[model samples]
Target: MQQTTVAKTVTYTGIGLHSGKSVTITLHPAPINSGIIFARTDLPGIPQVAAVAGNVTNAMRATTLESGVAKVFTVEHLLAAFYAMGIDNCLIEINSVEPPVADGSSLPFVRLLEEAGSVEQEALRNIIDVKEAQTIRVNDSFITIVPYDGFRITFTSINPHPMLGVQFGDYEINTETFVKEIASARTIGFMHEVKLLQDQGLALGGSLENVVVYDDETVLTPLRFSDELVRHKILDVVGDLALVGRIKGHVIAVKSSHAINTALAKKIIESCSK
Candidate 1:
């Protein structure tokens, strides 16, 4: 299959989840084979950074890519939107270190990309298909990629909170489901964790508007889906795998986080290359 990118630039502005500062990001048409690269516009000379598992040096609360003195944080949702939409190459230029946490969902980015108009390229795309059950375990959490004919993801969580109990979402990646099911699922957080995250200088851009904040028993807004939390988890997984370069095979994750996801991605790429 051929690669794709939008014809024109799309712009968006929102607050950074960590920096607590407003940020403006623009998606520009990149030459074929460029892949998804991030450019730090605020720095002198505007250095560029590649979006890949090898570039992901930090996977704390969110996935972070760093090279030399430059870094970008919280890239999963944006990456997932592009991956599920089948965008193969593009330039993500940002005025800040992180993209805007727009409504804490990929919906805004999805809309922006559609408005910009996507175009097919001449080069054939590359996908890393699983030849066997490739698995990686970290402590009690584990992620595995198994052989499948097309792209699919299944995610399960063990959060005890009422808003986040055991839940699951399964889908064969396609344009219709990507926009309706995955893109609208908002990233969620706990009300209590907010104070600690703030103390650590994280989630500074988080608010009830962007993310679904919950107390012990109450969700901040109406639930988008009964299993919205799980759906969002799948959303995150899709985004993280986008760093793998192109759409691949089935990925199954159980009780996994950003750290474990990136770790599994590294292992998969390494194992497949050999």
Candidate 2:
């Protein structure tokens, strides 16, 4: 398959998940082989940051990428949307350090991409076709990928909360399946963590509207799917995997988190390069 970029420009504005500051981002078409790059529009002279695994500095609750003095936070959802839409090259201009946390899922970003449109490029895609298995783990959580003809993912989340429990989802990822099945799964959190996060100066934009919170007693919002927690794990894996640009393999993850996800991404990049 050939590479692709946007057919037209699109803009999105909303509050950041962490900074809670209003920021606007514009997606612009990039040349073939340019890859996905983030530009800080608020800073003068247009400093750019490449959205690749090597630049990832933090993945606490969300993925953050930094290069020199420029950084972009909470990028997983937006990257997942790009991966779902088959967008290979683009310049995302953000007015601040974070992308908007619209509805806490990839849906809004998917909508942003739909509004912009996509066009094929004249070059072949730069992708990794796993020839051997690669794995990484953080305590009980682990994720691995092995050789496969096409891209597929199987994810399991082992949260013990009654609302979450043990849940799993498997999908042969493609443009249609990602949007229809995984794009709308909101970010899940425990109500107990809200106060802690705020005290730590994080998740300032998170709320009942944007995040699905579960107290020990019950789930705060009606779920989009009974297995949405696992589906969102699938969403995150897709975003983390997108750091490899293109992938052709099968991945199995259990109790995945951003740190482990980004670690697996680094392994994929290292393996593919050699």
Q: Least lDDT summed over 10 consecutive residues: which range in candidate 2?
A: 156-165
Candidate 2 segments whose C-alpha is farther than 4 A from its true place: none
Q: lDDT by residue for model 2 over 1-274, one digit each (tens)?
A: 8999999999999999888889999999999999999999898787888989999999898898999778998899999999999999999999999999999899999998999999999999977889999999888989999999999999888887867789979999998999999999989888789889989888898888888889888998889999988998899999987887789999999998888989989998898778
Give each model a TM-score. Answer: 0.97, 0.98
Pick the TM-score winner.
2
lDDT (Cα) of model 1: 0.86
Cα-lDDT of candidate 2: 0.91
**Residue pairs in collision within model 2:** none
Q: Tell me, by lDDT, which candidate is best.
A: 2
True-vs-predicted CA distance for residue 255, candidate 1, Å: 1.1
Q: Residue by residue across 68-112, what tens digits does model 1's lDDT show?
A: 767899999899888877788889899998999998888888888
